[model samples]
Target: MFDLIVLSVFNGLIYGLLLFMLSSGLTLIFSMMGVLNFAHASVYMAGAYFAYSLTPYLGFWGALIAAPFLAGLVGAAVERFGLRHVHGHGHVAELLFTFGLAYLIEEFVHLVWGRNPLDQRPPPLLDFPLFTFAGIDFPAFKVFMIVVALGMFVALWLILTRTRIGLIVQAALTHPHTVGNLGHDVPTVFTLVFATGSALAGLAGVMGGIHLVTNPGMAQALGPIVFVVIVVGGLGSLAGALIASILIGLLQTFAIAVDASLADFLRLFGLQVTRATPGWEVWSITLAQIGPMLPYLLLVLMLMLRPRGLLGSRDS
Candidate 1:
């Protein structure tokens, strides 16, 4: 029991951090540019595919470094040629452009990589077990993932809070015309933010491709969940995103592990849950069986109870 609990915690942290990696990029984009990119996950997919194509020649390390820049460049192009043209049309235009752009990216991936999943393996250096405790052997790749995720959080926080560039970026978010008059290239700043956000998503893909899957549909699978993380964490709050990601990660991991049914819960409270009781069918469902439903439920509760989100500073 102890070993199982311990192992589950590490697994939860890994899953949560993967989410943080993905959400952090989206958060950066939204917080800075006020654009909730519908195609953000597609950029993530591009990164994975980019890594898959590059790894054979450059190996994992090289792919890790190169793929993000490639993805960032792609994002920069979208912001410049695609998103930029639509900027005058307002948020609806931006949203529609990104929404359409997502489909375009998916089709491109299908045409290039086909519909099959790519078998991406961890690098040889971090492929083995790192240690064993209470009869549980933890994979080195998983450990590496946790470390990279944490390192990314620290780096992003410092970059945004402690740097001169960060100050200009934040100022631009609120006062673009003033900043532009002050000799800063506001459009260029927007492009950089989009590209950097996409780069962060690409970095997540470089690792997530191996940890999860490298396929065309991979973005579709994780995209909604990433949105949920940011919304629950608050639209533009990095700290909130981190907390929500961890909470959801832990919730889902433990939900999958626990075998208790809703009926068990009612009985625990001396409610005598049985088939004769009202809504017995729903009560009979097991936690593990309904694990995927929990996040949405939490989302609904959050919206009703606190619309601003966990650490949100402004109204959504």
Candidate 2:
């Protein structure tokens, strides 16, 4: 039991940080552009696919760096050519444009990569076990993932809070016209932010593809979860996004570790439901069986109780 607890904690932290990597990019885009960027996860899939294709010639390390740049470049193109044109048509048009773009990107991936999961893996250097706890081995790649995520989080925080560019970005998000009037090229700033956010998503994809599976369906699978993270964290709040990602990650891991069922609750009140019970199907459902749904449940509750989210402000 103690070992299980220890393993669960480690797993939770890993998953949480992985989630933060993805959510941070989405949240940053929202903070700056006020656009939901429905194609965000698709860009992540593109990164994973790009890495897979580049791994043979460039190897894992090269692909890790190159793939994100490719994704970011694509994102910049989409922003410059596609999104900018749709901006004057209102938010709905922009949202619909991205929604369509996501499908196009997915189809393009399917055409190129096919309907299959790639055999993506970490480099041999990072594949070995880092440590063993209670007879269970922890992989070095997970530690690397943790480091990358923390580095990104800290770097982003510093860039936003301590730099001149950061100040300009914050100001632009709130007042694009004002910044433009100051001759700072506000449009260029927005383009860079979109590209940077997409690049971060790409980086996350490269790391996560090895950690999870690199399937063509990967984007669609993770799309809802990413949205849930940002929404629960507070739409445009970076700190809120981080806290919510970790919270949801821990919640999912811990919930799956427990073997409790609704039937267990009935027994506590001197009532028991057996297989023969009329509602046995429902009562026998274990928490682990529905762990994936926990985040959505929390999302609904958060929306109902505190729509602004944990760290969100009135305007956020």
lDDT of each: 0.88, 0.87
* lDDT by residue (tens digit), candidate 1, 1-316: 8987997798889999988988987876776556779999999999999999999999999999999999999989998998889988888989888999999999999999999999999999999999998899999999998999899889887877899887777677566789989998889888998898899899889998999999998888878888889879986677888999999999999999999998998888898988998898899999999899888888889989998789876566
Evaluate model 2: give its TM-score: 0.94
Which is the leading candidate under lDDT? 1
Error of 1 at 175 (Å): 4.3
| Deviation in Å, model 1, residue 57 alpha carbon | 0.4
Worst 10 residues of 2 by lDDT: 307-316
| Clashes per candidate (backbone, < 3 Å) | 0, 0
Error of 1 at 108 (Å): 1.0
Give the CA lDDT, 0 to 100, for residue 249 in model 2: 83
Task: Give the CA lDDT, 0 to 100, for residue 312 in model 2.
Answer: 64
Task: Write the residue-wise lDDT of candidate 2 on 74-166 in tens digits.
Answer: 989999999999999988999999999999999999999899888887899999999998988999999999899889988988998899888
